[model samples]
Target: MTNYGDLVGGDRVHASLYADESVFADELDRIFTRGWVFVGHDSEVAEAGQWVTRRIGREPVIMTRDRDGSVHVLANRCSHRGTALCWEHRGRATSFQCNYHAWTFGLDGSLRAVPYPAGFEKDRVSLGLDRPAQVDSYRGFVFANLDGSAGPLAAHLGRGGVDMIDRLCDLSPTGTIHLAPNWIGHQVHSNWKMWPESDNDGYHLNWVHASMVSSAPDTYYQETVLGGETGNQSLAVDWGDGHVELDFRPSYRRELAWLGVTRERVASYCDALVAARGAEAANRSLWDGPPHGLIFPNLFLGELNLAIIEPTSASTMVHWHTAVQLDGVDEAFNRRILRQSEAAMGPAAFIVPDDAATAERMQLAVDGVQPGWASAADPRGWIDMSRGLGRERTEPDGRKAALISDETTNRGFWRQYRTVMSR
Candidate 1:
C-alpha cells in the first residue's frame, strides 16, 4: 500500500489520484471489487428470463430474472470453457449457452446440462455458472459485489441514501422507474474518478455551464442561474459514503421551460406526481430537485437518467446513460423525457460533452506538467479539495450541507475515498 494518506490528506488530494496507473489498480482491488457497485435496475430484468449484462468493477456480470421471479447476479462467463455466456447487452432467454462448447446454464445460472455427461463421471468441477458473492437491491436499483466480505449494499448506501433512490422512484406515478430501451454510451480518455468528484462539485456549474445559461431562455435563466437565484434555490449536500447530492429547488422544470415547455405541460406532469405522492413530497421530488447526484464508484442519478461509469484504465472510462422512464406515464410524457435525454443528456449532449472536455483537459494538465522545482508549490500532482473546510453544517439526519459555491461535497467524497482505498 502506497501510504494513501500521503496522497489524500484532510484538505487536499494528490492529482496522481487520477493520473497514476498503480492508484487506479489499487482502486479496483481495494474499493470497487470489495464494495457493492450498481449493476442494473430491477425493472430491467422485471420479466422472467430477462437479463442485462454490465461490468461490476472490472469483471463482467449479469443480472437476470428466472422463471420463479428470483433475481440472480451471475459472472456471465461459462463454467466449462471460460467463454462469455451472454454477449448481447440484454435479452429474454431461458438459458445461456456457451458459444464455444455448447455448455448451457439456466436462467438462475444453474448448469442445466453438459455435452456428453457420461464422459464426466469422475469430474468434480463445479459446472454451474459463477455468481457474485452477494447481490441486493434497494428501491429497485440492483447492486452486486465480488467480495462476500463487504458489508450489505444498504450499509454502503450510507444513512438515508436509500431514500434518495426511493425519492427518484417516486418521481413516477407508479412509484417505479425503468431504463429506456436504448442507452446513450460514450467512452472518454479520462479517469473514472474524475466524474465522481466532478459530479459532486456544484460550484463549477455556473462557470462551466455558463453556456447552459446563455443558451437557455432569458426568463428561465434569470429565474434560476442568473445572480442570486442559484444560491437561493441550490444546496450542496454530502450524503456520506461518497454519495453527494446537488439538491436544488426549481431546476428541472426550469430547464424544460427554458427549452419551451409550457407551464400547462409542466403542470400536467406534476399533477401525475402529485397524485402519486402528496403535494409536498411530489413538489420536492419533481420540482425541488436533487439534480443528478453522483453515488460513488460509478452510479449517478440525475435530472433525467442513470449513468454507469466503467473504467478501462488509468485514463479511460466509459459512461452509459439511461433515460428515466415512469412505468405507467403517458406515452407523450415518456417520449418528451426521452427527447430531453437525447437533446441534453446523451453522448452528444450539450452539457455532458463539456464535462468530458473538462475531465480530459484536467488529465492533460496532470500529464502535461511535471512537479519540477519551479512549480513545486503548484505541483501538478496535488489537488486542493480544502474549500469550505470549516464551513459545513450537519443536518439532523447526518447529511452535511454547505454553501453552493463551496467544495464541501468534494471533500466529503475524498474522505470516503481515502477510507475505502486505505482499508
Candidate 2:
C-alpha cells in the first residue's frame, strides 16, 4: 500500500498524485465510487416522471421523480442487451424504453416489460436492471454512492460540509435554490483536482484574476484586502472528518463597488432582496457572503450564487451562475446579476479561459511523467495558506495572513484528498 501520509504534508504534495494514470484509476474506485458524489439538485426533477441522466464516476446514472413524488436513481443501462435508457439531458417520462432492444423499466428501476414473451424463461424474470448502491439528498442537492456499505449521505458529508451547503441553500429566502437556466460547460485538459485546489488556494486570486482586479480598480479597496499586496486575508479551516470548510475573509466590497454599490447602498439592495425573498430570509442571504471551499471530491460553491465543478473526469467541468429570486424581485435586477457573474466567472469569461489554458498546459507537461508533484511550501505552517506559507492562526478555525496569496485552504483540501483517495 502506498503511504498516502507521506505523499501529503502541510506544505507540498507528491507529483505522482497528478502524473500517474494508475493513481487516477485508483482514485475513481477509492474516492469517486466509495464517496457520495453530488448528482444534481432536486428542483431539476420536481414533477412526477421528470428525469435527468448523469454520470457518477464512470457509471451512467438516471435520476427520476416517481409518481409518488419520491426520487429514484438507477443505472441508465437496459437489462436485456445493455443499452442506454435515456438519451436526453432531462425530460418527463413514465417508463424508459430501450431504443436498441424493446426492454423497458419503471421510474423506480424495476423492470416493467420486455418484448417478445417467449425469449426468456419465467424463472429468470426476477432478475432486473441493477439499482445504485445508495441514493440520498441533503437540502435539495442529490448524491449517490456505488458502494452499498458506504454510510448515509448526511453522515458522509458530516457537519462541516453540511453547514457550508446549508448556508448556501439557506441564503435563498425559500430555503431552496434552483439551478439557473443559463449555464456554461467546458472541458479542461487538466486533472480534476485542479478545480477544487484552485478554490482552496486563495493566493491565485490576485495573480490569476489580476485582470479583473485591474479592470475594476475603483470597486476594490486600495489595499487588495482579499487579493492584494498586503495580504490581509484570514482563513478558517473546519475539520469535519471526511468533509471540510475553508472560509476566506470577506473581500468582495470592491466587486460590489463595480456594481455601483456602497455602504450607503446596502439598504436598497437589502430591500430589493427582501421584497423578493422576504425580510428575514433576505437578511440571511445577504450575510452568507461568499465561500471558497469544497464539498469533498467534487463541488465548488462560491459567491454571487456561483456553483461550478466537475461531475466526471478531470477533463470536463460545468459552471453555473444562479440567483434565486423570491416571488417579487425585479426581472432586470436578476438579469444584471446573471450577466455580471457570466461576464466575470462564466466559462467564456475573461479569467476562466486563461485558467483553463494553464490547466491544459499543465496536463500536457504531466501527461506521461513517471513521477511528479506540486509544491505547497509557504512560510505559514497551517495559517499562511496563501502564496504557499505564512503562519498558523491561534484559534481553531483561524489562519492569519497578510494577503489572499496564502495557501492555507489548499493544504486543507489536499489533506482531505489524501485521506479519501488513499483509503
The C-alpha TM-scores of every prediction are 0.90, 0.83
Compose the digit string of candidate 1's lDDT tens values, residues 165-203.
Answer: 876777677887887887667888888988877766766
Poorest 10 consecutive residues of model 1 by lDDT? 367-376
Task: Please report the candidate that would top TM-score against the real structure.
Answer: 1
lDDT, candidate 1, at 410: 81
lDDT of each: 0.75, 0.62
For model 2, how big is the CA root-mean-square deviation?
Answer: 4.8
Model 2 lDDT per residue over 200-289, tens place = 555565667677668866533233335344455444453444344445435433423434455354455556566767867665446444
Q: Candidate 2, 399: how far from true, in Å?
A: 9.1
What TM-score does model 1 achieve against the real structure? 0.90
Q: What local lDDT does model 1 show for residue 48?
A: 93
